[model samples]
Target: MQPNQFNVDAANKLKIVSLVSVGKHPQSGRMRRADQDSRAVELGLKLTGDNHSGESLVVLHAGDPGEPNLRSYAGMGLKSVRVLQLDPAADAILPLGQHLQQCGADIVLTGVRAESGESSGMVPYQLAEKLGWPIVPRVADIVSVKGGVAEVLQALPRGQRRSVMVKLPFIASVDSAAPEARQSAFGPASRALMDIEVVSASVDDVRQAWEEAAARKRPKRLKVVKAKTAAERFKAATAKSQGDGGKVMKNESAAEQAQAIFDLLKEEGVLR
Candidate 1:
């Protein structure tokens, strides 16, 4: 479907549930960076508006309990947020879907993947399977949602794009290709003291053991190559191997240079 055909103003009105991973920021390295969580919230807010029908934005977190990031999301124009906490040991997909189902979320949105732990890049697909909802990865926009269906724009390789229509309660994994997430203002971030009511887990046995697991083993040897700069990285990329012999070339015409370059690339298996 063409993206221009759908009505974005209408889609922005539907209720949305945003799933996110609360983690340390790559730049700040804080324990739980609100900036990252707020970024995800910003996208959710933009797609589905500051309010979700009458239900607030649902920020589902896995593993971490501190949840310091919720404040930033609240600061960044989100009217309300629901924190669905789950057992850190349980399967992330199952628990996340269970919580979202209880919230009655019409559309579930999440980042492509988390920045910490497994970062599997499989949460959206897995959650969709568990919830029997359509999964759309690399989502760029929500154009419309009506009659229990939603129209969305998805990013494709090489700058290509496509629009699709999926039923409500579908799952979409937001890509970096979507609009850049905004920074949180300092005043709002500091003053926002949102309430966080931790929900108790209902599961008794949450552990899953690998069948062929063995005692943690360490490798006998280690090899490390560090490059401090871009030039060093390029040098490493073009470095000669132990079995490779250096070659001598004479200055030549443009065509000869081109042929020599092709020959070198072919020898290095860079050209086929």
Candidate 2:
């Protein structure tokens, strides 16, 4: 179904809050505008224009207001953005929850994870816990918003999608499959000013000090064998790896070659 066909209440104006952050460039290893977070902002803008007419979209940041990455979002057509100035070492969950409560937004949106620094993709779940609201993760699109509820298209593995309806006052983490964000306008971005809100929040003492190292290529995954019983699992685990020693027929009779192929097929369990 098309995204616009969902039931939405035109009478009620929605207060949408989107959380954004700076991401790390995969190749350059430099700080840049986050793709997923920017997509969330784009979704917020689309929802505001398509359904909640006349209501302004709110963009929130939990880091430095002067960061170049944060400034880039202004060009995406958001009139203004609010930045919460917190210590680099502080945990963003508590302060962000307080800010959301103060804003009293009906819907909150964010990315699956930050691209830099401890990319644990846990902010949405943490924020939901703090706000006592339900979280819908990996949302592809907002199908419709009406009657204080939102119907969203959720992305799934292997090019699949599922539609879910969640009540308002919920958190949604936008997936990369959502609509791409528009290019940043230089004129607007240069003139944009962030409303910096200084927030004093305690840093989590449980976090351990860590050192950074150059990222290495990920190791290849091992093939898993599905087994239902203990004996089957043991057999699968102890099975010998296939070796490159299959027989090759070069000068055999036609019937013999065919029989050999059949035997090989039977050995591989390809034929009963």
Evaluate candidate 2 by giving its C-alpha RMSD to the native, one decimal. 12.9
The positional error of residue 271 in candidate 1, measured at the CA in angstroms, is 30
Per-residue error at 60 for model 2, in Å? Answer: 0.2
For 1-272, candidate 2 gives per-residue lDDT tens digits of 57554443451378889899998889988887899999998888777773322136788999777788787788787557789999888888899999999999888999999998788999999999999999999999988877777888999998799999999889999999998988887777776778899998888666646767778874332448989999999998777666546677889999999999899778767799
Q: Candidate 2 has which clashing residue pairs, if any?
A: 9-146
Q: Largest lDDT belongs to which candidate?
A: 2
**TM-score of every model versus the real structure:** 0.63, 0.76
Worst lDDT run of 10 residues, candidate 2, spans: 3-12
| Candidate 1: clashing pairs of residues | none
> lDDT tens string, model 1, 96-151?
76777877888787888776655667778888888898888888777667787777
